[model samples]
Target: MALNLTLKPFERIVVNGCMMRNGGRKTTLTIENRADIIRETDLLKPEAAATPVRAAYFLIQSALIYPDRRDALTKSAQQQLAKLATVFTPQLARHVFEAANNVSMGEYFTALRELRPLMKRELEVLGPAGLDPTSPDELPRIPT
Candidate 1:
């Protein structure tokens, strides 16, 4: 099995913690093997991680990016999730808790998959950090 993707000029991606960017023209990439690849649009900037769930997701990404600190990051994620439990829907909460467990067990890829739905549900519930939903200009973009 393989993954094929097309990138616009200057689009970026992270493969095995290595950041890569496309050149002037649009390019297609064929990933023939398993690799940790995160598209730039999906990159969660640390500064933008304001909510607990967002922070947890960012921490999970950090665990992947900094293997040397995976344990520490996983611990932080677990603590953050404890705080977020109060606000999470039952289903979302289940996924997050499972993700935390996956992290603790050193199953990072599984943890990441579990956290994706957590992030999505967080946005649907909270509507982007601190933005006022009534204000059209103060919108947020949730990466898919």
Candidate 2:
């Protein structure tokens, strides 16, 4: 199978940690083989990782962008997930566990997908509080 990407002018994507930008015109890219590709819009700025779940997502995102540090990033994300599972309700925690399991299996993308729903749930639970300063429970700093 292949992945097709249609990018607007200047749109960016990170493929296997190499950042590429579309030229002046719209472009279409067909990834004929498996590769780690993350669209620019999906990129999460480190400073904006305010919530626990968001932090975890950012860590996993880092793993995709920096595969060289995938071991360390995956470890940190798993630890964060473990702490999260303890605090969240059983239903919500299930997702955290699933994400952790995916990370452990080297499925960083799947782990991210699993955590997406929790981001929405966190917003509902935290409401405006989610915009506050980063939570102390947020995962440790990830190298740039």
Alpha-carbon lDDT, every model: 0.71, 0.86
Candidate 1: count of backbone clashes, pairs at least 3 residues apart or interchain: 0
The window of 10 residues in a row where model 1 has the poorest summed lDDT is: 135-144
TM-score, every prediction = 0.69, 0.88
Model 2, residue 126: displacement in angstroms? 1.1
Stretches > 4 Å off in candidate 1: 101-144
lDDT of 2 at 110: 83
For residues 1-144, write the lDDT of model 2, one tens digit per residue. 988899999999999999999999999999999898889998878877888888899899999899998888888888888878987888888899999988888777888889989998888889977757665565358864
Model 2 has an lDDT value of 0.86
Query: Candidate 1 at 17: error in angstroms?
Result: 1.5
Off by over 4 Å in 2: 135-139
> How many residue pairs in model 2 have overlapping backbones?
0
